[model samples]
Target: MERKTLITSTRNLAQLFATLEVKEASPQYSLDLAWPNSHNISVSIKRDDLLHPIISGNKWRKLKYSLAQILGSRTLHIVSFGGGFSNHLHALGFCCHRLNIRFTAIVRGDYSANPSPMLHDLQMWQTDIQYVNKITYQQRESPAYLTLLHQQYPNALIIPEGGSNKLALQGVAEIISELDQHYDYIIAPVASGGTLAGLIKATAHSATHILGIAALKGQGYLEEHVQALLPQTYQHWGICHDYHFGGYAKRSNELVDFCNDFYHQTRIEIEPIYSGKLMYAVKDLINRNYFNKGSRLLILHTGGLQGSRAIGQRASIL
Candidate 1:
């Protein structure tokens, strides 16, 4: 009887993934920068931002397998931790709503006073938005706190803050198969380290070097998170800590100006939080002649454009 039920759940989840209408592969476009490339290096962007308006880019990739596993299990309720304007929560809320699964977003800080655009969407999606203090939220990954949550919601599947798990790595690694050709270096913005770790896993045996441009201030902290998710040791990947600007979601005038100019030059929309910092780092590296003369670089445009709506006028390029 249990086996029969499991088979049915697996079929249902597969059908749901099929009906999700997500783009199987995002297109890559050559970047035409206004500045000249003195090193004769070429840069192309894998437009994963075009994956979906909401569940786009790394968000979709990171959550795809997790959602599949959740649906195959007896658990129908999902509990996750994130900030009020988190793209992970926003995408997960939409997916859960579409699948008719119960979702509870354990958001950090009291956004009830001034809810973000993401929180508003969560409400519309019928998600249980639970705002907790920073101190309590800090215990999100603690075994004791997770045990407490397991006790509270026995039928719930608890996803970590950014949905960075082994399942997420599997989905993220799929990006490598979708690529038409290989490049010397593959670069992406690092947040929870899942995306970078995924790229690392995909190119683990390959000669391609993976570079993660940090969007936040964490140096050793982010590396530790990436290492935890990786199955084995890999020296082909490294994280750059210079382009964080001012930590996660924090923006600067210089960064904003660069994003705006980039839009005018290439017409590719980027937010200051993630993609902006990524492009900025790439350009800075290029100007500093970081890449060899014949090196080709592939930039992963991990989409979180929806979260930009929360910042409103801050993302003037959007």
Candidate 2:
């Protein structure tokens, strides 16, 4: 799609708002699995993965309020940061295209010579892509770099990397209201910590235990980041750093095999980067008898099926 083909009328913005307003909450399904222990434990999954084809799961949740702010403003462009296979940029590009706003991505590292599947999708959406070295990318959070970006795109709304902001947290917190019943445990995959932070804030007064399965290595820093996002200190949540398998975007044969077996049993496709690690941790914890009898677990499938293509290619080569 080209910029010329984008519809930039207020009518279109109104229609888009209406489209988002009427979207039904994603469904949650109970899973029937035989546990080794004799405890009466129930497991369920929230199908945020089926929320949308391109802009699915927490990606949509994180972007919903930001997109609304952009639509309400006079800014004609959107700017953000991401890596080669960032689902954040992928979803942002498509959202900008649909909203008739210009989109630019400050991509980490140089991937123009060999674009990943996500980069290809961004280009298809006509997102202006800019490459920056790792050293410069690290300066993304600095005021100097942010000022420079604002100078480049004068009337642009700049979103932080991973779309983790107050507005994004508000969007993720809505997941709490969509639940039909209370769960003893709420589990989700954690990368940049936005989703987990939202869950912690939402369940602050409840007895529910929020669990974050880290998807990257060296996740000790995630606690600080998540704490910085919240209004107050919360003690009802914990993060598991053991399920990453290797690191961000890194997969092992065990994770791949587990994903295949999970798909065969549940009929729900999961990629290794996010949902696979979450499901793996759930099963592992269950076998270890981490939960008591009659405990209910709710797993959030935060969607990243787009990354599965890369996993499939890697598996074939191995």
Candidate 3:
């Protein structure tokens, strides 16, 4: 059950306004939103015309700045990992076609005959989908796990899951270039920590505080994940290990009910994986008076809404 944000105000001062005009490299789309009081958080859906295109919002933001680094050959077989029905996979497939590049998506689960709508889109994008067992999928970042993939596909440009790596951080960090210094807080859900890490690192030593709502369960290891980009220096900022509904892709009835209540109140949909937990955490923090009332908090609505299908099946999709 997803509801969009109500754009009630005359104008929002906090949202990072995007170029809605489609261009040569990418097209533009906006997040249907209910503008927040502090600052409206939004992302542009860059509609790329080819395979491996970033169908997900900010997928373009995460990829735009890294194309040069990734441009080695005219035809490159790109590899990335995600669940059986990953938006990342779908986007990567479409994007690859656009660039005329060969693409491979190392998925976490067995190929489902009847996959989620998003996964079907990946197939439509002609993603060469490979399956890994659940246990092995859990260890994707481990050296041995990478070794296995490398042994099989040695030359593939394997992007880390959630696109959370140093290169990805470079892409995400470029977001602040268009922003002003008025925002007091920044909020985004922590997945593999690439986006969160980018935001925090970009704002390091600045007055603006960054908060990440964990969208996976038992993210105690996420600190190690984010810091993997930087070594041991800024460990304190990667402080979200809870609030992930349950691990990476699990949710409960309570969270579903919460999403419904949230929709009723705000008229905005919060996917079970990400924005749902973020809203839950942010509301709690607000009730506790976590920040100054007048200070602006920019909640980045990173679009992973594709995952909503599976959760919706469980929640009885509306």
Largest TM-score belongs to which candidate?
A: 1
What TM-score, to 2 decimals, does candidate 2 have? 0.91
Sort order, lDDT high to low: 1, 2, 3
Off by over 4 Å in 1: 1-14, 313-315
The prediction achieving the highest lDDT against the true structure is: 1
Cα displacement (angstroms), candidate 2, residue 80, comes to 0.8
Q: How many collisions per candidate?
A: 0, 0, 21
**lDDT of predicted model 3:** 0.62
Each model's lDDT: 0.88, 0.85, 0.62
Please give the range of 10 consecutive residues that has the lowest summed lDDT in model 2: 4-13
Question: Model 2 over residues 75-112: C-alpha lDDT tens digits?
Answer: 87999999888889988888888778899999999999
* Model 2 whole-model lDDT (C-alpha atoms): 0.85
Ranking by TM-score: 1, 2, 3
lDDT by residue (tens digit), candidate 1, 57-109: 99989998788877777789999999988999999999999988999999999
